[model samples]
Target chain A: MSSVCLSMEGGSAASTPAALPYYVAFSQLLGLTLVAMTGAWLGLYRGGIAWESDLQFNAHPLCMVIGLVFLQGDALLVYRVFRNEAKRTTKVLHGLLHVFALVIALVGLVAVFDYHRKKGYADLYSLHSWCGILVFGLYFVQWLVGFSFFLFPGAPFSLRSRYRPQHIFFGATIFLLSVGTALLGLKEALLFNLGDKYSAFEPEGVLANVLGLLLACFGGAVLYILTRADWKRPSQAEEQALSMDFKTLTEGDSPGSQ
Target chain B: MSSVCLSMEGGSAASTPAALPYYVAFSQLLGLTLVAMTGAWLGLYRGGIAWESDLQFNAHPLCMVIGLVFLQGDALLVYRVFRNEAKRTTKVLHGLLHVFALVIALVGLVAVFDYHRKKGYADLYSLHSWCGILVFGLYFVQWLVGFSFFLFPGAPFSLRSRYRPQHIFFGATIFLLSVGTALLGLKEALLFNLGDKYSAFEPEGVLANVLGLLLACFGGAVLYILTRADWKRPSQAEEQALSMDFKTLTEGDSPGSQ
Candidate 1:
């Protein structure tokens, strides 16, 4: 691991040491609070949850808010939060967290489909459903590509360098898409349940609005931390050094090596 | 302009000379296509727009999609698109495009509010409306702050540098928020107008869904251009050189100067 090399070379000097932990902690709090708020919205306002009744629909939102938005976001933050950990350790944890999020999200998806089937309602008809499927599909593909390229045995050195930027870009884009999809779902859910009361600032409507804002805020917070160049894992300087090595490696090698 | 200095110093060497144009062109086409699609959806399916009647509400989504999502996104791309242009020129154009977007978006806002008020319906109650207002409010603030810091004779160089990253971060976040809000609006609008037929795959619903996907695709394209480190203006090497200048400028001076 590059991090292993960094530690061996006394390259563990992380910048802004004092600020990052607070950021990580704040993100954790917001994520957790969002999950809890989603649960409360479904339980208190939408009736209690159960698999056999129409209330099973509640699990769709609860599980998605926790698994997709909250857990998935926290998984993305793992690399930065555990900046000093072994790169391999973080990579494995990253993959594992994604796995956990995906499985929970799968449960959420199944809950909705099973509920819809019992009621004989349409499936994957609304824009929310379409976008939801899109987000999940893309996230899965991204996870697979990331696992193959960066985790398992790893792609060739040059291949990894070329793909890293794209991997990061798609990861961030998929996260945004997931958040947007979740917001769409929230709006549809509120409208379906509250009907005209949604136009009158009903308690359920108000609660859902607050939840949407929290999700947006949580999303913004995570992206800010992720984009802050100086806060990059292994420090920015070491990152450049590593990339510079990448430059040299590519410049010296041929396509045959890959 | 830093770019003026760069030109004086022979530092105008943009990387990815051929690919950058295609990227910019593709982004422009996507943005234009998205705006046109919104226009078609409103015109054909929403029964055309008018100054009065419920039809006026059509302008809300149309203008928001055009101004907030498409135009605003293109505005953000100006810097990277014209990487070789004068920084001051590009900065003014950037501010102006934002102004243009805000004005068009204001027209959209007024249309919806006036429609709601005429119908005796509540305003800003729905999650879409709430998020829409938030996106617009943040965009206004972001534009104002960007103008004060980067234009209007500029902040102190040190202060400018300090705020630039935040400006860029918040700008991207707001853009994303606008896209999310647009998707929410599209979903609600389709549901409201198409009603139960939406679940039956109405043409309008499908059109709106396609439009939402285009918006997401456009956002991703613009952000990809924005985030690619190698595609940065003044070239990455020159950017580092400029930042190194800032480094000396900050380290050599007192905070009192700023």
Candidate 2:
């Protein structure tokens, strides 16, 4: 996925000024990662977070790394938006969504680690799952908005001039995978009644299941809306842009030609 | 949803040549319902498939009605495509999918009705569930392919556009609902597995549950690919045609203007 995003960036270099800010967005993501890791460590080690052997607390390192990678990619996108010499308002706003995704990921991961180690399935686990759900939620939106732009460029408000639907798909797949992963984990926590191991956490687990399903449905609807919104626009600007790109599209036989 | 589709059709009429066929598609769907209903009655009566009770069979007429409505809508879409003066090949192809959906729904209704009457899991019941699964699978694809086109009239082709990330979610929801509905019927067939009034069908029910999940995932993936294909070419073609719509786009702030 990262490779696809990079290649897309590479391809867009000579297209238009709109592509520049995405580079900065990627850089901003890197910086956010560093900040998040430091924050997580401080919260875990120094902030009186109790440790438990049963808990995969050490997974924090891996989570931090993953979080940072995503952040780095996102920050660069942000940089491309605001700091870059040639950038569009749409790209800038879209790039900042990466920051939203980072925050959600950070909080969700920490909550999961903390709640899991605590061996509790009440408020804490609920919080953890909710955070994870939100993370996936935000990431899904990011894909619908920004990534769609990248895949279908000639459309009104897409990301860039490239026709890499694969990148957008990967981003969406990751978001779904992330949601599924969290659901599986939550299912485990529910069946085990992790927070309430002594008794049946059936109620809680069921609640979580329902919530997860609801979240997925709501998120899916939002995505559909976003897709519609992305397409529904019939902008003169986009028409002008398409006209400009028609020569390249004809020569390229690319999917973005339309 | 019909109203939504109509509004969407109205949104695209001036700018797109492909919009006309959906009206035809809807007409085809309406015709299919009569055929489907005939098939359902024939499958039920000629095959000695009487309902266990009139109340049970009569209860969900509303579901049938709802199904018919969608079928009708789909038929109109098909007709519009075929009858429209400015027809695109893709539009006609899309209309054909309605037939697939119509067949599945009819087969499924028969299976459900017979199982309810026999009060046991039957070969027909299993087929129905599988058939329903197939229909849902197609819906996933249709939405994935047609969704963005409806939503973003002039957007580019992204994986997200072709494949709804939320489809996994709504797909899962619909699957679970279908499973639950099946189980409720199966439980009747099994006599709650309390005393094995119908021990013979237990294994079949269990297998259906397992197979349903697997197929839902696999079928969804395959259908998604179909959506991707449908979206790719048109998005590119639309990109090429975008310049021609510039003046209209500017005049009407069609959703794409955003």
Candidate 3:
């Protein structure tokens, strides 16, 4: 079952600007661009935002773009970007970033729900809401599971090793779902808020479309980084790391370190 | 740098149901399910498909869901599923699947534009249209480049090997974009057709929302398959496959074979 084309996987030239950093930087740029565009769409065209008012609904998109999409993307990048950092430090930073994302995302959820209830509008009826709520719920659950299994140190080394791939798979999948959900929300926003004007290429509509494209591009960049076998973190002394007792013997003090 | 945690990446045990087959089967099930759902949506709810009448627009979604989403996904899975097949046969099968996808997708594109022209509905104004068109355009270009580089047998071995990663990256990324655009189109379809009924959870709206979720799950499964390092196509042989004279000396007649 060994791969037949491992050597054909190309390598980056030493003299070239490192591919990983470039992609990481590009992802960050697109991330902030979409977040900023979402903010502008809310502030400039949507009458801005506030707590407990119609404007509060504006906070929802802005916060989602910021917290769920932007910050969440960065959190996933923690290990990749800080590859040389002590694994323990990277794990904490990773968890911390996710905490911030979850908190902010919670506020975004509240903003929409609060607005919906105040206006007597039904909640969770639209596809956008369904996708969004699923993403958020999955995000929370993923974090809880991730923390307990990977960060809390209670898991047996064998178990942790076993669960690692599933964790990464789900993490990557959920991040993608967040991106897809954000795009769904964009369509909902344009149609619900802009209406016929969205069809006429109104500035707000154009901005939102651009935002949607940017989000997909950001997601693609991240996925590209992730799937590039060359970009994966090195298996430092892979055999020892794989050894059943290595984690307990050498890293027991930091039992949960990645 | 090598990954510091390679051993922890985990592997499927021999006793388990072979995971690759399970994921590949699961992806196919989701792909066919969503394609069937799309057909049902268009035929039952959206008035059905034709060439030049108002019903022509129905062809757009149905063909796209089948050709672009389902067939294209299966095309991407060709390498992984046919791992032991003769490389020449697999390459031809891959290209042929894509050719079929392009033709079908082209018909779908024509259906939309023709319908728009007939109805005097402005085209490419909405985010859905913009995203959908972009995906189609890129799909064409990707197919062209992939054929010439990997199927036509004209490129140098070094060049083909180098471009392989980019090809794989773009292919995966474009597949994802196709899925994203479909979700956007679903939102537009629901809003444009269902309007207020969508908010009321009309059957059509609920059906489309389910389709959207299914599309996402299908995309995720394909992606999971794509990104699993364990699932990557093997190198046939390391030094030989990567050797500068690999094709010229050993397999020139099958120069484009994977």
Candidate 4:
């Protein structure tokens, strides 16, 4: 086996695998699928909003069906990738990502179903369009990151690889941004749907103000995550080993090459 | 090496360990964390208008500090566990989670430092008091989940093991209810904080309406994650195996034992 494969199989290496990062990236994308399902649910529950009428879709029923479908697919994928695995650390990581995917899909299902049942408003889409954008954007970002990995042979940031670190750094940046956007979008969608009932419950509007502040904070968190983490540049020797073909390169060529 | 260790060494076990369920449980908690953080950020920006003022605190500053500390600790743990090794799978998982932690921390930092830079808002907590509630509630939720893990060795679907999943189920339900109540409280907060800005932005009450809908979705998402992602209770035999010490318990006692 190649050293990279050996490292992965032996559990003696320091880095996580490519499949794992893609797994996380994909997990984040599940949030988008939730938005889609939620939107569909809201439409159906409200008996199909006037605005969405022209879209040739029934909201509530479609939401339930599609949401369930997405949930199953996402959950199954996560299970296939993470469950019943061994190798303490790796299993833990993959398992966590799997859970995240399942959670997001579940949330999306609820959001859509509840909206459909409550029919709380006329146009769920007008105000909540941002949520859809967030979900779609997140998935797109993950796809890009996952697709990028196929271009490279081994993991990033290894003594034998230079691009690995950069890939990680950029990939993370994309994920955080996507998350922030999703949160913002979700808030906007909710507010648009139920602002009137909210006023009657609280004469002062304290809740709206507080939620707005929270959105700002979440946005800040996204920014913080972006700036603090970076791909560490490789040392000179490490860089060279990463450049040469493994077949032609001597093991001694790089002193720190593990 | 112990046979138990060997069985789990390559991380190839077909059955999930107790830790697996907790990891899955953590995912649900983390989803709530995301929602809470999002709400907290919005509250800090708009003030604690979305929910109860009693829940308010300096969400931005406190979050920044706590988030950073956690990120640091998490990163160190990851590095210690995975760094300098040469495992593809390990490396990928480590890198992704590390990035996730860092990105979230960074977003918090940005919100904190940028408080003074914003145009409309004069002070940090000027947004609303209810936002404090969101931060408070979210942190409390996070603490509750983490402590539950400490209290219960098994999570998600465990019938026994100190902390019953029922208690967790109730706690999560209560948290979701609190979010709904907070949403109903946000109307006045949005009216006062947004004022003319609210009017200027919309088709007569569009902004508030949108905010309401988004809050509804947020609440909906919370409910979904708590209820849906929870693992189903294992079969009697499976549960028995799960409860027993894998190493000490002989397979002869249970016909179905793996």
Candidate 5:
């Protein structure tokens, strides 16, 4: 088995398996499946999708799951999954996926707001809404900084090095916040329907709860794969094959090399 | 300024500050304050505390915040805070803190269950309860495994080394689950009283929402400090002062020494 060297802070390699591609791929498939299942739960059981009214509320969960959970996760995994590929290509894919997630999440927010306005319900009223809005706002800022610093017209090598840790920190934080918000949203939706045949123990309620649990599980797995020191992307000699047009590339080199 | 060598896995030291005592202490104080504030909001603003009936419900949040949010966080930080201290002592403190957290959490669970039983309300009837119970169950298992494998009469060195990563991963996962559960419980409590003077926009409702936000922030900060590589405990030269009763002690030695 080929071993990958994990580079911590641009130096000091720790050997782990380079064969994590399959694991990353598997997590992606499982995470996407769970997101799809949650959407189906809403579309089939709760109410069919529609542009306005209660049906519009369904779009909120569906879009948020697809965008925040699936797409954003894929964005984070781009580096690990494409470890052998050119660094520039993986960086492009990461930025692009985040953009897509942002657009979809915005649509999700609009859907919920429209529904609330039609129903004469107050906006930003619940903890779920508050968290959802906060995550979205932070995601936007993260995207902006990432794009400007790492993607195009990148920052100075010193600046990029300083920001790298913060970038990873906030990225993981926002993802966790999204997952937490989704769970709270699901609870609110389920509780609103509770009573009569649709109590918390009923099949529909159970399915919703299971969806929330799955979201948490998916999130936990994704984070484990992302944050584990053993699972970090290996810095190979081939990484230098990519043109060093961006000054920030120097940040990854050992200080002795300078 | 003293620099602590961050030993990843068993070897390869990277120097970072040994001066993180302030950061750790500050986070602990701030985290506990947030937990206390959340509980106080429930007790003082919503309704005063009582031993039986609806008033007894106040004990649930108060105890849960103290146990799951504050105490559990402290348990996770023991290793980092006592990095220079004896490993055995830190491990014992870690386990003991978990035990205290578990006891307080059990009391919190009983408080809610008693209230429900007295009011003839259905049990395990909300997403919050389901998640809360699941977290508690997993926590029990985590504690058992940690105590048996890492503390007294600990497992073989090989086993302990293998289990270290899993222990850290699960510890973080359970803590996040607790925070998520707390947020869901807050939402449920607030919504149940939303139609009356406790409307979402009301002062009490706003305080409740802020408490949920604070819990999220506190969890994020705790996880950041715990997970950051640079913030890991330094393997001091004096670590060898302890008896080599456990074979795992050799793991931290440089590979050349081995």
Candidate 6:
């Protein structure tokens, strides 16, 4: 996978321009705003933030929008954004962002579970709950594997090479699943509030639905940026910089060194 | 985009195998089965296939599932499945399949509109309707662009090359949006039938929810197959064969040709 990244980096040097980074930054800003707006709609307009009541349910959307949609997108872009930096530093930042996303997501889950328990609502009964739990579980496992294999002491080169593709593939799959789950959860909330007679012409219903559309758009944009071959980080000079860092780190770890 | 495909094909020669095709086939089978099952649950069990009154509403899910889920997926896979075949042939098949999908989706839309008219329900008043209409509209434009640029006399090579990546990106994006719309529609259907008091413990509700989950799984699997870089078709020999065909066709098209 690193080879793929490196090759893309090499391929991008002549084709990409300084303007791309600005476009990416703009996309990030737009995506984050949409996510935050969705959360605000749910939390503020819909009475989701009140304590010790059904309002506690609002925390779920707020945290998830922040963690899964916004932070997760930023994490995916870290390598591209910091292309000139040392590879190790980018990787570490990527891992840390994922960790933060996980923490926030967990809190989101707790908010929903607490709401359910307090209201005596049956937990894990809807398709949304099932998907939410499954995505979270898989995310946790993915994080552990990623951290152990790609960070810290790390795996041997051969093993890392083999696992890298799978890691990226799963990472992308998890992100889409998160977005899908959020849409499902949004649908559930809207249906619950508006009942079967819900109409898009209604202000609140329209807001919720538009929010869902925005989430889908955000996911699509993030995926496009991450997956486009031409948008890959440039590699020519970065290779030299990364190798120098690697050599220094190795020399420091050598037994006879000091 | 063709260059990217060609390069991956060259890279995949050593890595991909005959067995990889089997996996793709299996994914197709599983995805189609899940889509069909979801339709069955709606059409057969939920009175979707009934001829009169609200029962006619059943046509919506059935047609949408067949068109958006099954045919749309097949259209996306045409280039990969027919990699060894001429590019022109694959492009035609891809365009035709999308046309068929659009026609069926239009029928599905009509069914819902007719049902609304008969039942005195407002048309295009739900998020599901909004999403469904938007996806269908974009799909139509995408098909037109793809057909004009890639098939028929076709655009100039430079233009085709430029549009290719956007075509693929939008195609995948539209497909994902279709799945998202379907899930939302399914949620609406379930909530209406099961009422706001729905508990996941109910057998029918569970079935509906599981069907939605199955749809998500199918979408995820199809996307994985489509996006994985290593799974790209081999290009070296195919390029030679395509160029030969192009030469013969161009020669045949010359004005002085007997």
Candidate 2 lDDT over A1-258, as tens digits, reads 011111122222333344234433443444444445434533543243333443344344334334523442343333223332333444445455555656646654675557554865333222223334554565656556554564334443243534335444445444434434333343333333333331343444334444334323332332333233222222334444445556545565465524
Tens digits of lDDT, candidate 6, A141-224:
999999877674524555666887788878888888888888888888887878744763677777887887788877887888
lDDT of 2 by residue, B1-258 (tens): 000111223233333334334533443444344345433433443242334553344323223333423342343233223332323343445445544544545554664556555665333222223334444565556555554553334443343334544443443334333322332232222222222322233444334333223322332232233233222223334443444344444565563533
Q: What lDDT, from 0 to 1, does candidate 2 have?
A: 0.39
How does model 5 score on DockQ?
Answer: 0.31
What lDDT would candidate 3 get against the real structure?
Answer: 0.79
lDDT of 4 by residue, A129-238 (tens): 33444444554455445444422233233432344434443333333323333333334434444454443444223333443443333333222322211111112223
Score candidate 2 by TM-score against the native.
0.34
Q: Can you write out model 1's per-residue Cα lDDT over A3-27, one digit (the tens) per residue?
A: 1111222324653356778988898
Write candidate 4's Cα lDDT for B126-163 as tens digits: 22224434544554454455444422233332223334
Please give the distance, in angstroms, between residue A226's alpha carbon in candidate 4 and its true position after superposition: 20
The C-alpha stretches of model 4 lying farther than 4 A from their native spots are A1-41, A49-142, A145-183, A199-258, B1-192, B195-258
Quote model 4's TM-score for chain B: 0.37
Query: Between the candidate structures 2 and 4, which one is better when assessed by lDDT?
Result: 2
Worst 10-residue lDDT window, candidate 4 chain B: B1-10
Question: Compared with the true structure, what per-residue lDDT tens digits does model 6 show for residues B203-223?
Answer: 777887777877877787778
TM-score of each: 0.88, 0.34, 0.88, 0.31, 0.87, 0.89
Assign candidate 3 its CAPRI class: acceptable
Question: CA lDDT of A174 in candidate 1?
Answer: 86
> After superposition, which runs of candidate 6 have C-alpha atoms over 4 Å from their true positions?
A1-16, A237-258, B1-16, B241-258
Model 2: DockQ score:
0.04
After best superposition, candidate 6 residue A172: deviation in angstroms? 1.5
lDDT of 6 at B135: 91
Fill in the DockQ of model 1: 0.37
